[model samples]
Target chain A: SQELEQSPQSLIVQEGKNLTINCTSSKTLYGLYWYKQKYGEGLIFLMMLQKGGEEKSHEKITAKLDEKKQQSSLHITASQPSHAGIYLCGARRNRDDKIIFGKGTRLHILP
Target chain B: SQTIHQWPATLVQPVGSPLSLECTVEGTSNPNLYWYRQAAGRGLQLLFYSVGIGQISSEVPQNLSASRPQDRQFILSSKKLLLSDSGFYLCACSPSGYNEKLFFGSGTQLSVL
Candidate 1:
């Protein structure tokens, strides 16, 4: 079973539209991180949240960690064509544990 | 100012052949290293990880194995290759066990014939 689960496996939106990708964990998540990967490329580090109910932002993307750190969501505001990629959420129970990954959300921006 | 490097961007191998993939990190010492495999259009699957030299942990059981000989060098190898091993192999490292911001290498696309 996957420890981390992402919703809406794939999505499409017109340029400048907003979208959100959700992730949930079956176990308590001590650290939740988001990464983006273009097709056939390696993952690019995005953001990480440790404390419960923590929220972080990077340009047009905002991510929030729930109070229990059992769930998280990444919100893309005014998405651009460059934002098109597979978004993955990874979580670990603690620093020394293996990071479990979600299936990822594939987003395509309509030009 | 740390960077991770992986070589042979692409490789084609036959069954029952030997395999070796190397990864090294610069500008950092005693960092945690990891290897992951990704199928086409899928998420990353952890293959192996190491917290220090001579300390490799396997996340998934397979014909492959990993070794960490140096402080910042990790190697993934197999004596007998399998066609099911074809996929994009990635190498990553984190500053320590605390931060989840693991830096990744460009990756190697391996095709088994």
Candidate 2:
């Protein structure tokens, strides 16, 4: 079975609109990390969460990891065109450092 | 500070030709190196990983092979290129001895003609 799953494979929103993306895992995620990639480019690490009830933000983008460690959400507030890209969530279980990544969500921000 | 480099940013090879993709990391030692392939509009698929020099672990059964000759160097090769080899190839490194988040290279785009 796929270890990680992402919701709403594709999304489009007008600039300045708030949007959210979700990631769920079949197993508990000991560590969760998010990455963003632009077309024809490498993925850039966004943030990492190691605990339940953990929330981190970089500018307008914020991510939350529930205590259960089975799910996480990335919220973008007052989104902008620059936020348009593919977002991927990776999960590491227990102490194992090998991460399994979600299929990814393709986000499009229209001006 | 650490940086990963992959060469031949773009490649166009014909069927049955040999191929080689290289990846190197600097500013860090004993890093876990990985090779992955991403098909167009698809997610990343792990091909192989190595924890140390001369130690390679393959995650998928494919026509490709990987080698780690130096602590921070990894290579992906194929004796004969196949049409399925057309995709973006990425090299990633995690701090060795642990499961840290990966630092990826700029990636190489290969098109098999």
Where does candidate 2 stray beyond 4 Å?
none
Q: Candidate 1 on B59-105: residue-level lDDT in tens?
A: 88898999999999999999999999999999999886555478898
lDDT, candidate 2, B1-113, per-residue tens: 67999988999999999999999999899998989888865678788989999999998888899999999999999999999989999899888655578888999999999
CAPRI category for model 1: medium
Candidate 2 interface RMS:
1.7
Could you report the DockQ of all the candidates, in the order they appear?
0.64, 0.60
RMSD of each: 1.4, 1.3
Instruction: Give the 10-residue window scoring lowest on summed lDDT in candidate 1 chain B.
Output: B94-103
Instruction: List fnat per candidate, in order.
Output: 0.65, 0.42
Q: How accurate is candidate 2 locally (lDDT)?
A: 0.89
DockQ of 1: 0.64
Interface RMSD of each: 1.8, 1.7
